[model samples]
Target: MERILREPLETYSTQKTQKFVGNPLANKLRGEYQRLLEEILPDRNRYLVVGSPGKGNWASCPWIAILDSLITDTAQSGYYPVLIFKEDMTGVYLSLNQGVTRVKEYYKRNAKNVLRVIAQDYRAKIEIDNEDLTEIDLASRNNNAKLYEAGNIIAKYYPADNLPTTTELIQDVRRFLNLYEELIFNDTQIDETKNLTALEKKQYRLHFRIERNSNIANKVKQHKGYKCEGCKFTFSSMYGSLGKEFIEAHHLIPISTLNLGNVQVNIETDFAVLCSNCHSMIHRLDDPSNLELLQKIIKDNLT
Candidate 1:
């Protein structure tokens, strides 16, 4: 069985890997890899074997890549949890492939260095555009050595005793991607309207009101009541009936897309009500803090 597993990586030449996609031995090797991954991963549905032995460009080594579906619908655009085995070395690592390359161009031109930080977090090797997938090869070693080393690094973040079920891991990865997008692509924009009146052109603009539907705000007040979703500040309780319907509505959608012509906003999912103070603090940062984060801050402060 070990020999079968090693055959695709060790015995096969580069040409063989490219041409042996349908070969019986190659299929068996690929199947075994999937079986082993199934034992380690809980939600088989969350991942797909997008790349396998004997199914890559001629210059690339034999590898199996398990993709996180939440990050990308296809392997062509997202990163993957990859197990790469080459004659000189092997290691399980994260490979940001063509899909990620595309994202680097379109969504985050400034984020070229973010993946390096993620790799450092895992202590996992990084590979950008090299089809050879050889950047992870640290020294001359066997396939099992590489797998063991990679497994240890993965186990550090996801231990065997408390393995993150595939679903949990996918969610974690999604959050990581969100934070990455937030940190790397966060752009601070200032209103640049020209010919402001003397008062409007003041050095410090005290506030800017983003347009929102008053009906939606009223519905939230009706359904959820006028309690701050973050710190649970109730206006009526604090300030009598005058404050009953005074909670501010914050749109949860990305600020960049809020005014797009065809953009749709679902009140329940897209808005949160907050007390005056919390609302001000949420927008204090260049990017408004999400309600969950604000709630965490409140909880943390009390505890």
Candidate 2:
């Protein structure tokens, strides 16, 4: 797997001890900083800045403002810029690719310097040590690098100079943001329940089990009024508003384990509901008969 580059401040907590300047001066400084960043960093691809407010300080607010201004200015200059403000380093970085060239140019110009910082801090470098350099080369050649390489190809094939106007840049950024938001937030899990076909969706709903593995596991704690028949452990989706904790439905007989005649059976009746722990235990045994053993264990432990 290709290793991701990490920033210096990412690992160690750097003290941003600079006193908050007055609003006007702070704005001026922010503009200058952003301009310098534009000069040093690539104009392509969006930027993600991980910032902290730091012990009763409001510096992050100004920092975010600076980022917003930078993105706005880049948009006006006919370049797409997506600025993501991460509250901490642990969260997944959110970024939107505005225009092809914008991201390509950004990475091409900034990757080395960025990698240098990452290397200095992490004491590591991105090296292709794979035995199959040919495979790696072929992957790179085939545009398999997804975000980075694909953007470069698009930039090379269709330069930003062809973009023409600020309006076009804004429109491009907006469209990219919309698609990105949909993929990240709305298209996840049960939200996708609506998009599935009638049969597929019915199966999904019926067999939808909220295991500890589920993305919305935290939300499922509230709906545990229904106890798992296998383990006798109660479950609910009452934690968050999403109500994810309810009974998790699972296939008692694996889809693959089904007999030829039962292949066409309804999924709802074919599945069994189990609590999170019981569901895990069921899968842990890997044998269908283990469900009975799991039930016995649960009965012995609880009683």
19-58 per-residue lDDT for model 1 (tens digits): 5646654665468656655444445554566445544322
Task: Give model 2 RMSD, 1 decimal.
Answer: 17.3
lDDT (C-alpha, whole model) for all candidates: 0.47, 0.34
Per-residue lDDT of candidate 2, residues 170-194 (tens digit): 3433444433323322222443523
Model 1: colliding residue pairs: 76-99, 77-99
Among these predictions, the greatest lDDT belongs to 1
lDDT for 218 (candidate 2): 28
lDDT of 2 at 248: 70
What's the residue-level lDDT of 123 in candidate 1?
36
Every model: Cα RMSD to truth: 17.6, 17.3
- Overlapping backbone residue pairs in candidate 1 total 2
RMSD of 1: 17.6
